[model samples]
Target: MEEMLNNMREEDIKEARLMLDAAVAFRGAMSSAMRREIMKRFCELAGLPFDEPPTIVRRNPFEDENLRNNLQKFISEWCEVDEIATCTCHELYDSFSDWCMCNGLTPPTKNVVGGALRQMKMFVSYKSDATRKWRGVRIKEGEER
Candidate 1:
């Protein structure tokens, strides 16, 4: 596959460059309608597929009131007041789930909780000693302490 990919004709490369330039110009158009039309016209001229792929709009977990409430409860219950700025959320999911189960509440999935934590405007990450790890801190009155 690599060997086959390496053997590209100069004409094909030039054509791809021209298409990219057209796409860039189309992106710079002031009107969104005009841009789309230009893109469709360019595709027609280049003999390329003009069909726009279906857009996937994923629901944000943080946007859910129940999940946000659970997160707040978990933070207040489990997180230390002083260490809130340096607390890690990845480990909190298991306990949060357990708490929800015991309380007969809808238990949120770890992935959803993680995503919610990451997206919430109230939570911010701080650089920690661990190279790939970030500590989640809840913002107080929209201010970072």
Candidate 2:
């Protein structure tokens, strides 16, 4: 379950980054305050500050490093180097949660990539059964074989 949640977190950060890209493209035409607001909102929702976008890893569970020391300054610094305000965090969270629910992911998820990668093992072993020989081996989870 934790693996699932962690995957969602990683996905959220990636999508948020894309939105930040969009924000950069629209910078001159859009209101600076509004753009900044978007960034602020995203950080707050993600439990991050403006500057401290943590390096999320899926080693054991779904926790991030605590190197994110500054909030406002971090945001400002990030804004300077990367396109931070282009995407709002709310949208990323919403999308991530919705995607997880739709995919039947359990709560407190673990390593998502691990779960997915393990599937190859299942596939290799599945065909080993004599009764299943020459039969259509279903690929997707929750699907009939």
Best by lDDT: 1
For candidate 2, lDDT tens digit of each residue in 32-88? 677877788656546664774466665533222221122122223232222222223
- How much lDDT does candidate 2 score? 0.40
Query: Under the 3 Å rule for N, CA and C atoms, how many clashes does model 1 have?
Result: 0
TM-score for candidate 1, please give it.
0.42
Q: What TM-score does candidate 2 get on C-alpha atoms?
A: 0.26
Question: Which residue runs does candidate 1 get wrong by more than 4 Å?
Answer: 1-59, 83-85, 126-145
Can you give the TM-score per candidate against the true fold?
0.42, 0.26
Clashes of each: 0, 21
Note the Cα lDDT for every prediction shown.
0.60, 0.40
